[model samples]
Target: MNDRENLCLLHSKDLLDQKRLFLLFKRLAGQHSVSIAKNIHETIKEFNSATFTEDQKLFEDLYKIAATIENKVIDVDVLKQGVNKLLDNRKTIPQPKPEDLCVNDSVFQNKILSKENNQKTAPVPAVYDMLSLLYLTTNEKQRQQHFHDLTKYYYRQLKDHLKQLSIELDEILPLPVYEKKIKDFIPNAKLEVILHYLNQDAKEDTFTSELIQELYLYVLYPKINIEDCFKIAKEVVGIDYNFLSYELVEANGLLGALGQYYKLKLTINKAGDDVVLNLFAKFMIDFPKDAFPGGEDAFPKVGDAFPKDEPPTLSLQEEFVYTIFVPELKNIGLGNICDFLPRCYFMRSSDVMVFEDLTYSDYEAVNSEEPYSYEMLLLVVKKLAKMHACSLLYEEITSKGSGETTKINVQFSKYVMGFSQAVDTKFKDTIHYCNVNTTVNYVYNQFPDVAKEITMEEFRERSRDIFDSMLDKMKTSGKYRNVICHGDIWGGNILFKFEGTRPVDCSLVDYQMIRYCPPAQDLMAFLYINTDKNTRTNYLSKLINDYYTEMSTIFKRYSFDLSTVYPYEVFMDSCEYMKSYAVCQAAAYYPSSLDRKKVQDLLGSIEKTVRFFAVDKTEVLKVLMKHDWIRSRFREIVEDLYDLCLQK
Candidate 1:
């Protein structure tokens, strides 16, 4: 077309572009990157509606090219550069896109920086191409990696910006920065930087898409329903994220001995209530209908598959899993408190993987640089204090039975469901190939008599008694205060967030065993799982002191008297209880955490089990035995069965 006609077209398109820009801002506020890009393309077509001046047409052509950014918005900073090219002398405004930046990115680092900061970088077309493609992809984990590569997947992303907003970013952030940056369009990008940090703080293998989705929605749309995300999995998601699988021993099959797996991507309005997305495990497909051939019997019939006589893998693997997302609920708005869980707790839940499920050790060995230490064990004590506080305030926060529902139907016994009782119940050959010479086996082997007396059946019976006792304590404790206890606060569940603000700031997990009970339950349970020599001597007392100190911190918010509960004597009582449970919990779990070879031998070491418990039991009983009248108390606890059963 002629210059005059083109000029007319350019002017008309500019007007249309102005209107569209406002809408783009609106979509950005909603964090709608895809929709925003589509609208921008529509606005660029306005250039074709009218004629333009020679100079105007040239500018309009640039606008048409910029409109092609159909995945993410033109880093307004980039657009500002084109604006300068159009109006040659206007250099004062911050240029969203600079001509010198790499507009084209083959690896996508530039596009990520653009999306991350909502601005331009070295203008290179290769960068744009890679990002544009990633935008179109359907994977979340892959998308996150693409974004992460730009920042080297560390807190280094805008680290300088983080320090600048030191006070705000230093604390745990409520959401990811990329989502926040696109919203509100604020001048200070502090929130955006903080968002990146929150993402970095999460361990990669531990990163579940459900947590990411849940956090994003909860922080942004307070009213979104969780049902919308029930079906979301690795194949679905809008945000570009990548699964981080740590090196692990893989069992063959479509399911590679599922330990911690993941999926990731972005979203449009993919959120449910509280804007948080569930991540632990996805919904398991329908049984039989989706199972391998052989009608309903094709799949390994659920039972105690762990060769107790041989303990191939802990019988835990056979547990039927209904869902697969490792839950990491985020954006927990506890008003002023930054703790994510106060707002939401992580439940490694699956409809199919309920308590009545198959047996299997779902976890593998964690490479702890050092074994559990006094300092680390102390951190766990503090964790118990915090969880107990939350439980105590359960009634104040919500009416629902937070911990009771889960605990009521916990492992009542180790009965092999669906199988007949005629099977030779006890595993005969106790020594496993892996645990023969390990310290775990050696420690237990020292005392063969007591360990030999306790069989799997006996253990199950004892567990039932323990459960019954717990129910009674829960009832009595309810009159005082009950908090959500990590019913199984073993070393495996209490994670150490060593880098975050609260050095010992622990994030709990595996909530299947969550129970509504006294905080003492959590304190005892965690100590039972992690307590050892140096822990008992050098750190135990001081740790209890620290827990009280931390308790005071949480209590100050609710005006609680520290002395009324958790006194030195109460703590001592609690410690004795925790010690008693050590033999039971350790026997079942040591195999999963210790170096595999050593861990296995220890599990089948009945000789060691008897000996270890003998010493442990004596020490534990010594504390309670101080009161010569304790035998009667024990009899009452064991015999008053109905009173001990969980009421809820």
Candidate 2:
């Protein structure tokens, strides 16, 4: 076919497809609307003579029917008729005697009567009156006019409310008024129609449908008069609805799970534009009490499980990084790295940390297995050097009492050196699982005969011993000199900004594990967790040299001798000593670092750490075996640790 003919044929096919889709949607919408109308009618008929005892069952049935109608488009006329019939039946039912009324009914009656006395004597038509006028009228033109007028009324009500709140309405543009009239109105009209239609009826079905439709419209169309709904809601409930806007985006629950995660996007209007905020909220409301195989509690309190005076809480550590460490880094002319850290706006009710999103700023997080180029690695190493140098300078400045400084007391060693009972438990469980699992066997089988000579048991024992020594070293401010180490320096924690394929800048995050430890802890963690076997083998020396050189330059700028503070020899020794710990961390975290899917799955799991190891073990083991450089590195570390154990 000719190019013009092919283009014409494609356009015709697209048009036909769109028409088919529109017809299908229209048919489905009509069927759903009729179904919902019938269900509403049946429910109301069944509940017409229902006693107070059957009220709960009536609402439950209505709730199920309402849930089915969600996301389905309905005919306005059918919905109006169903609602009016229900309302008429509700009015015909005999009212309960004063003595027969429940406590809730009596309280509601008194509250309404008191409200009526305080307000104006003139009776206003309820929302049902407006909906009936819009729907039942025979003139299509009049119905359309009524819909437009009703929308304008709601917007005016929102404006009045805003004015009452002492907000300047002139500065804040009202929906439908500020934007293109026809374009904005079309999308928002459906929600305004639904809300006005469903408002006066107090039935569970009506209220739920209204709420669901409002939430749907609020998210899909930003120009909806959501503030008016909030105002009306507050007046009806007699309590302050202080929040601006909240809409749930994702929700998942597992049976018998201790926790649940809810992802929500909130809209807060400040200045002129709306600021959309994304939040992931976790609730640890339930506990199994005897979840473990031996009838031990899975979730234990710090005081019950550990003897530490101060437990390392994620909130406390994050707050410290936000309020203290970030400012210090910026002060030392290392603002580039600080830009990567998630800006904590505030801690809401202790558990929720509202962070300024970097995704919107074009900073993308690299996935697991996405190879970091030399330039990208260089950028990260330079930032790490600046951060470490700043830490040294901060300590020196604080000691001299030249200005206000945060008291450094929460050492990384105190938290990681068997101090956190949770970490200690996870460590034991992970090692035990690795020792017994076939995944490890598969990995060992792939290694050379010489490497395989070290039995799994011996490997396990050597790993444990190395971890102990490393912990002891981490706990003390030893001869190697301590600086602020990004306790969790993995691929997942690092975010990079790129100009096409080239990395321009980088940032470090997840500061809950921040600790005062040897800088090698951060360096090794990054190398082992981020780099492939080949990259590590080829560039490890150069990277280390560059890191020391950058650190030296930064120290000199701050008027401190790099040798007196942290010498090149000491840094190398620390890296060598911490090699075993790096390998162990790599084994534990490598699976999660490989992909976003793994990270999300791990986050959602009940036994997060255990489940992460179980799911990722085989994948990580395969990576370790397949890559010659990685396999060699692992074998070398194991042998070095084994020799040291033998010497001891």
Candidate 3:
């Protein structure tokens, strides 16, 4: 027979097996329920048909049957006895015809046989294989043995296909009602609930209690009360409790976002007992046009706005790392540094990602004020070097026989305009709230020695020009070797595991802003935002050396010569190029990183500084002088900039 005919015959055989199994289960359950009812009625005379109405007796029997199923009180001895009695009475029992066994007539037709052979092909023997044995064996003992084997085979098949029965039940009743009904039969009711939801053929318009129960079982806990299921559904899934109808559920502001996230959680399972999974569902759906100010126009598009080869969205970038980059890193025996990555359970496009919660391991994010210590800084530098080396290796592997120049798949240039625009907007708003000229004059007066080369006009002109061109300069500068940068490397993006006063390990998170740029972009941004002035000045050189050592070690492992690929001198020059970008970023972001009340206080002082310093007055200088932290930070930035300029 041809392959197609063979496949058709095999499928037909499976269908026949399923149909026979279904019939066997129906007969077994019916006989078992009747036998249990007879015994119950015999014990309780009041429940007997003679004492009670037929309908009432039937109802009581059904209730007892359900209770027995729920309590798992089925007796195997009684079941065997009942099956034996049924077999003995088979002469009086109606036999299912061949037509009844084959649900679809066309499926059993000659079309499934090889026409070239024109010979009847014997079907593959299966669970029903012993039927002919029973008839052929004239000896009572052999016939009985065949019957027992057939019964055992059919029962085993019935148990194996229970999930298929559940699917059939789902079609007969609504999923919620089907789930409730199956709970009595299944020990793991939560598994049934999860399976039912996942197997759903119809899309739901509103969140149902059944759906909430499934989510609670998977995302939160295995055993949860129904009331708490509703509560968690409301609190965690962002559903409304007051309105449980489809209208209200569909109208929920967070429904679309929650739906996508819920789908993601459903797709992933727990990795191990030690790891706690936490999904950061921070995405928004259908945001208002005014929310992003410029709407879709402000964001870059695929192919048109960014290179066609690069990943167009943050989700795609993260997906690439999890699927391609991380695995490649592990392949090269650098999985130790990869511990910083939360174990990715699964990722769907960019809309949904499930990760193991690192908090379970006592890892916490450091805030802006709490900078990384010298030891922690060394670990971070090593981690960054590993990350960069993996990217380099990935580029080499993907480019190997393509005969094309190796390039990182991420596009950093797309974000430059958007970031510059945001900085400019923030600057304008600050000037509108206070006075730019006044703020500059105040800084110049407060640090006359630092501002000796620049007048108020010069300071105003240079600051605006610097903000506008900073990203471009960082991108174009050949001082550093281009590498994949963890685009958002501030304190908030990193998590550390501390062993009492010292950070022994660290992990990076929030890969949404990953990009292709010089390694210094990440290095400088991380240092400036996560370290104090003294830490930056004193340990900067050592940290760079630490990063290079790690990078060189990784290269050597992969048989690449570091001298030609990325030398120490090239790295140092990259740091110089990154210095200007880092100082500007730190100054711009410093105010936002402060406590809310502190930010308000600083803004108030800024307003007063602007009013006084507008006409070259020194009153604002006193306010600036009071905030020693701010003054020190600015002083360090100016010193770094001055040194950079002198080098030029």
lDDT values of the candidates?
A: 0.33, 0.47, 0.45
Q: Which segments of candidate 1 are over 4 A away from where they belong?
A: 1-260, 263-369, 396-481, 499-504, 565-572, 596-648
Descending-lDDT candidate ranking: 2, 3, 1
Model 3 stretches with alpha carbons more than 4 Å out: 1-212, 215-287, 302-311, 328-337, 397-405, 410-450, 474-480, 594-635, 638-648
- Would you give me the overall lDDT of model 1? 0.33
Per-residue alpha-carbon lDDT of candidate 3 for residues 1-648, written as tens digits (9 for 90 to 100): 332332232221132233443354344333322322233213221210111112334333322332344323444344334333333443242332221111111111122222323433332111111121112111222222233334444434433343344322122222222222222212122222222222231123111223332222322321212222222233333332221211011111111111222211212112222221233333322223232324445343434554432334435455566777677668755576566567665343424455554666788766544456899888888888888887666566555646776665342345422222232344223322233333344553555576456554555566555554555744423445566567667665578899998788888876655666778788887778666778987998888888888888878887777777777788788886677777666654443342223433443433333332122323434554466775776566555544444443
| TM-score quality measure for candidate 2 | 0.54
**True-structure RMSD for candidate 1:** 21.2
Tens-digit lDDT track for model 2 on 1-648? 332222111111132232332332233223222322233223221211211122334334433444466545544444444444434444464442211111211111122222433422211111222222222221222221233444345335434544555543334332322222322223223322233223323244343354444434444423223333232223233232233455544444211122244444555444556655564333333323233333343332345332232333434455566766677667756565354455654332223344544555677677555558778888888888877776776676565565654334433333433322244344334333553343234443444343354665665565566555555544435566677677677776677998888899887765655667688877877777677666877898899899899888877776778887676788899888777667656654544455545345445544543443332356435534565555555454444445554544
Task: State which candidate has the highest TM-score.
Answer: 2
What is candidate 1's lDDT per residue for 1-648, written digit by digit as tens? 332222121111132232332332222222222222223223221111011122444344334433443343344445435344423322232433221112222122233334544554432222223223222221333333233332122223223333443422223221232222222221112112223323333222112222233233333322222222322322244443333211112121111111322221223343442222323331222222222223333233325643232222122212211121111111122223323122121122122121211012122222332346666666666666655654333333332334433221122122112111112322211111112222123323332333233543443345455533433443224233444444555555555555333344455544434434456656654554454433445665676677768877876776555566445566566555444343334333343432333332442333333332222233223343344333332322222221222221
- Best-to-worst ranking by TM-score: 2, 3, 1
> What does the lDDT read for residue 274 in candidate 3?
27
The better-scoring model by lDDT among 1 and 2 is: 2
Best by lDDT: 2
Candidate 3's displacement at residue 365, Å, is: 1.2
